[model samples]
Target: MPFVADALTATYKGIPPSFQWPVKFCFYNSLIAFVLGAATGNVSQVDRVWTFLPTIYAAYYALLPLWPSKSPLPLYPFVPETAHPDVIRNYSPRALLMFGLIFVWMCRLTFNTWRRGLFNLKDEDYRWEILRGKMPPWLFQMFNLVFIAFMQNVILFVIAVPVQIAAMQQPTGLGTSDCVLAVLALLDVAMEFVADNQQYAFQTFKHTGKKDEWPGAHIAWTKTDLKRGFITRGLWAWSRHPNFFCEQTFWVLINFFPLVAPEYPGYAPPLPLGAGTSLESLFPIIPGLVICSLFFSSTKFTESITAAKYPEYKSYQQRVSMFVPFLTPVWGLYLTLLGKKAEVDMVVYGQDVALDEKKKA
Candidate 1:
């Protein structure tokens, strides 16, 4: 294991310093997480770095323009005179945009997690506890090392790779596609904000039993209030995990910046950069793909637990969409474009759940 870790470390160091430092930062953080998790049985060590690391990466990229080229710092190594003689070293507009957006996101996520008591480590994610219960101790330990500490940290860094890659290339200026990508990122953020607020409101209402007393989204689940179960309101009415969907979409949009950049050699979404001809260039897409896959698997596990807890979840799943909210509207449009009549399944519930007519009707 030490040999493998050494080999990985050496490989990381071989890259330019811009990539080298962030990769090493992620590696050390994950290693610390593994040690903490193994010793203390708290697998959420990775969670602590989740929101902050991306901001660091984004800030690294955003501040590239400020670093003097002739300086002895590691930032100078990113613009190897021989390799990137023509590369612009100015601060990237796209990167500045990305940095600002990520800062906002990091604050929101950190606040949300902190509010749930994650900052002091007083509370670990429920998913970790549930997995610990299901797996034997030894197996769970292995899972902790491989998945929680290693894989998750790696994935988190990968999702932020675009910011690093963009800074490395240092595209001349923001274009149409860059603006579009920025807007898309913010729109996803907005969606996630709405979804999270809805879920938070529902949970508060449920736990406090102050549905009518509270000044938020009304939770008039009289029939299921006695049962005490999942929420089916606001963004939840359209999709089971709207927040997860938005989260995935935002990262995927991050990957698009490279595609739209004027300096990118490739024509596709996952434009490779190192040497342009090697398979390593394709590595940029790994973060987005991995995140999408992770969310899919995560949703399945979360839904199972939720289903066992709530009797009506199955019916909700049968009626409303899962990842895509109000998929019927999109599907209906697709069918209409093909000159075929399609009836959207806009009805989610008969009486117990009431959906806003603006959703489809």
Candidate 2:
């Protein structure tokens, strides 16, 4: 692992400045995980599939030498030793609710990623291709292995620890709030899945067209004479990037579940005696909220990049909401604050709004 770490460092040194921050963030998170493992003398290879480091670290901490040496209760149905007796004894129902929500989130996201050919060894994301153009193969591979592959996965997993902690420490009982959260999570996953599928189908259709044939069968390709590659139908029509909106919504909903217990009506059933108070009572909601905020900021950055890429994007932005569909009135405030000028029948894809150049010319 030391040799692997050293190799990763060297590879990171060669990357362009723009990609370095996210890559370094991953490395830094992994380093912290390693240090924590070393300090607890529990250093051992954990399966890469369960890469969320916070839950792993929490479980590790729960089973540390300082605590009564026994397995923690399972946080998810699949994860072993996730919830120990000590944890369960102090469990908060609200936390467990969040845990369940996150489990669903992880499964959906992991499944989507797998289906998108992301799990295939032969293919990688296009963003990686862009990075490769600016760096050596070996160095890029090492950087990807450590930062993109290992560390990023670990950080996401670890950041989700609050769900596990909430489950372990919170009491358990069904409630209207839980039902509401479940519904929201389901909707979030569904929207993201649909958006991803649509985008995938559009790209595939574009690639398989005959040499002389016009691009069709996808909304983004409708104006075939125009060479705009932007997606603009289905959920994309509602929000230029619906998948991003759904992804952010999913995480926020997961984080919000713990807070719901306190807000739930008194008619909601209480947990068994000794199960403790609400999950938020045990662990503050602020950290998870802050993490959700960061995720939203990241989504904004992605949207900005997308807008810059597609000439038609600004016009689409004027007509559509960014994060919320059918919430045009709310987004109007944002446009006003930015002092954006609106133009009717603005063509987005073919040429710069300022220029009337034709494709051939």
Candidate 3:
């Protein structure tokens, strides 16, 4: 415990010992995921538990008052670093609120994963399957170790670090910003829910021709929905991936919740300059920026596969924004002014894309 505290402050003075437990957990799980995924060649090991890890991290902070001294919970390892007596007796109301929101998020994602049958132990992400075919076994294993297993777990832990921020601060009453954040968070979840339902409906109807499924059935499906080979209706029509857009927005909103502690024990500077907690911090923006960059790169990779499979998807890509909602129309205009929007729109709207090519000849 003393070693952890020393190592945490070895480089910088104010790095919180609260990170000890989570840091250990990250190491253990990353090793397990890499080993299991490498042995099985099913690299979705992290995906199965992704929904719950943050909630676990969150529970540590939100319920810090309830935790036994020196650990998040009894029998669990934790930093022996001193905790604020005030926080120990009466916890942060804001952390509780943040935990509640993330709990809702975890539930929504878990249910969606269940409905998609991803909870099955053997299931892997479709993208991983593609990557396996493209890369050599040695290189892919390195990727699994570095990116899929370790880096992703670290990111997941970092994103939840904001909640840990909540624990270190002095307890306070809920403020107006909390109300605004709660409202916007709910709205963000709602839009993502609709986007998910629309995609589920399309996939279901495409296979079973069953429009009777509860949430997905809300939309009326037509021949066009079936013809395009990819969704271009509902929120999907608004942005190629409205759900992803909301996902990024939700975390950024979570990052903005009103707890400013540039001097807090847990605060870590994005760069190495200051010796103590006096360091100016960019901690809040790190989670949002990291995730947005991940989404951008992942979206590009995902679209590459989709574009190759469906000829019409290229037109959809040209017509729609990848993650921003209203910007789809703006991009469509860009295609239009280039004198190709009509043909592209026809393709995206489920008309014959080849007809324009034939006409050009």
Candidate 4:
């Protein structure tokens, strides 16, 4: 077992203990995911494991010190008696808090994916099929290898890199900022869960004519709601893709955990760098920034598809902010001042428009 484990992880020994196995994991998953995708003609291989990988990396950093000398993968490592309880009575409490919060995030997303039947090995995101039609066959395969398999895994790795910040600063125990961030991260997750369920409910109602299952069915969905061809009520009224907003924000909050915690010592979001400082100095916030970049590009691609499918979607774009809720009305008002208030309102508030029309009739 030791021999085989060493052989598997041999290539990564020179890398830091914290990042050693993760680089391997990322490579292995990317290779296998790309191969399986090419062979199976399903490039959504990475999507199935998306919820698990980041959490696994979180655990790697949080529990890094406990990693036994003999283990193959660095997960659930053996703890020695000499180790401080505070660092990992189970794990780096700061990183572990990030882990716990991320675990909850994993559960919510996994459940959502499962219910959507996306967990099926044969099923792929509908968007991929649309993309395939647009690109040449050879070029699409390159995209599958580059973006779908490799880069997505890299993003997963980098996004969880902030936990490495927590891991490195282990002696720093959880403080008020940790608790505050935890609450905010949970709130972010809660809102995302709501957005997922709302979309789920609307999608269910759209297909089955059945109201969504409880708690999630916050809005009493109607035929008019269905007629809009996309939701514009509840959180959707405020942000075009509230779920995407939360998904991106969750990581940004995760990045902040290590930054502001005074106990972590010398950490800040953007540290003061000497002219000699390497670009590595900025790695902490890259997670949040890159995830935001991914989401921004994804939203644009997705909305292009959506706008083509549903004409009213353009007006929704004009009226609602993309990822931030508070800016929604401001954007709407800006559009209104540009003389699009009525058209944008008619589409975005089609339900209300219907009610007033019926009343007048």
Candidate 5:
């Protein structure tokens, strides 16, 4: 199918006819939700609500292929007569590839998240627990409805519009780069699956007492006889957060699809300065980059909390690299930088002493 049509169809699917209202309805409803979130200070709740928007949208698109009629309604003027756009229509093939990729990506992610116990009609993320506890009942409830539930949901849906837009511009044929991108995407999904499964298994094993009986003498334990926390084997050994690394890399690979399209020569640029040439060029990089940054920052913040709680975490930090594989290089760089800073400070102090001596003379 043509990418543009596929993206448009997927986007349209996100909003079902049953819920589709006039433009004013969307605007007013969203405004009210935002206002409620703001009044209650539940911004995180808004973010959580936004996560489900894509799944809801994809479900709508899947049903479109089953529709018998091709008639366009007043409300949905963009609905096309067929799954793929006709070649005579000058649709870009690159766009179609991007759309397909994103659809697959979204499907995999939504399914994974769902299986991980993330989808509850009335449930919120554990991170929100602290914030919710601080606010009054009425205020938190209002915030949850507005910011946590409504506005956040809309924003995530809107931000994802670019993938759909890019998909709509698919080029007529694939290229070497496109083939490479396909392989990368598959690897990304596979890597993520392995990481998630490994983590889940380790956690389950610990809970079930399987870890205690497992025939491995290398496993570390704390002075209190508790298992020293953190995954150190499998992909985790390659990178401290291999799952996060794969997740971000997957998005970067997905973004490469648009660049490989013949019509979108503007998308690809040569490295060592390989950066997007236009705002559209940056679309693929944003999601993974933003998420990874958040992951790292959160990890650091949590480490601080863990250090306070455990008293052994400082040694663990010394043993485990943050996001990258192995700690030697990072620690070496840290020492190098520290030495430079110390040298600079000593030089400045020495200069001050010399000036003082001259003034006394």
Candidate 6:
């Protein structure tokens, strides 16, 4: 892990030393959030910051090049813009695009979370509350400090580092790959918007008893008790967590923007302005892997509760893909014919078969 961390650090050869301020801010904020969460018994302080950091980081990069003093930010020791023939005289276009995308995402996410009253300090994420009941107080506090507060913030910062990478590059011109990235990012954002709206409409109708105004494919599902449980139509039908899929894919595409330039090899990390690609370019993908792991664990935790609450959720699990869209049938067929473990759910449950039993523990 130490070597892995070092290798990951090596990937950002052209990042300015002044970028440390944002990292320090993240650490201090995370520490404060950890202490406050432990004191107040609400772990959502970290969640509140999640939507905002990418925009902050993107804006920081977009503005840093315009800073009036070079004395404040030490240039990248490995590379200088002078060595590149295509170096632009102004702010990076890539960073500006990222800033715009991140700012929009931040606004949408913040509004949705706030609309649910999650912005209130008294309100905690239901997932944390559920997990807390299952662990000793001391153990759960440690988990909150380590995983919830510290590690999650680190992952958030790491994933946004690609914006910095893109900013460091000298803009020659936009290429076909840049346009492709833009399209994919916009599509992912659209998918996430649709998924969130569908879920929100379902929940609002479920609570308000306003079935007449149910939007999208939700109208078909509301006639049954299952509508009170989970979404089964529209984007949800394509994947159990279409929003999660899109969120992960969006960042992966952002990371790819730095890689797509002809100057950087497909898998190589960006180098000094005049340098060639090395094997280290492979390291930038680690952030995407971190995000995928976070979603995998998150889905597992969320589904544990869902599977217990809704009996039909297991059936839904067997029918629909977990992350990737439209692959469940292929997985189901393989498990049935070859693996001889067709009865296995996407995730195996423990002996605590009842939701009440798990809650009590």
Which candidate achieves the best lDDT against the true structure?
Answer: 4
lDDT per residue as tens, model 4, 103-131: 99999999999999988988999899999
TM-score between candidate 4 and the true structure: 0.87
- Per-residue alpha-carbon lDDT of model 5 for 104-160, expressed as tens digits? 666666665666666543554555575567789788777666655554555444334
Angstrom error at residue 74, model 4: 10
- How would you encode candidate 3's per-residue C-alpha lDDT over 147-217 as one tens digit per residue? 99999998888778777666666445777777888899998987787788888888999989987555533
The CA lDDT at 236 in model 3 is 83
What is the lDDT, from 0 to 100, of the residue 15 in candidate 1?
Answer: 64
Strongest candidate by TM-score: 4
Give me the displacement of residue 46 in model 4, in angstroms. Answer: 0.5
Question: What number of clashing residue pairs does each candidate have, in the order they appear?
Answer: 0, 23, 0, 1, 21, 2
Pick by lDDT: 3 or 4, better one? 4
Alpha carbon RMSD to native, model 2:
12.0
Tell how far residue 240 is off in model 3, in angstroms. Answer: 0.4
The order by descending TM-score is 4, 3, 1, 6, 5, 2
1-361 per-residue lDDT for model 6 (tens digits):
3673365357435443534445555666677889899888889888887888777767776665544332244322122343232222456677677777778778778877877777777888899989999999999999998999999888887787777666667455667877788888887887787788787777766777565333343443334433436676567766889889989888888888877766465323342222444634555676788888999999999999999998768867776788898696676686678663334432222222234345758
lDDT of 2: 0.52
| lDDT (C-alpha) at residue 283 in model 3 | 57
Structural similarity to truth (TM-score) of each candidate: 0.80, 0.56, 0.86, 0.87, 0.57, 0.77
Candidate 4 Cα deviation (angstroms), residue 181: 0.5
Better-scoring candidate (lDDT), 2 or 4: 4
- Model 2 scores worst on lDDT over the 10 consecutive residues at 74-83
Q: What local distance difference test score does each model get?
A: 0.69, 0.52, 0.77, 0.80, 0.50, 0.69
Candidate 4: C-alpha RMSD to true structure equals 4.4
**Candidate 5 overall Cα lDDT vs. reference?**
0.50
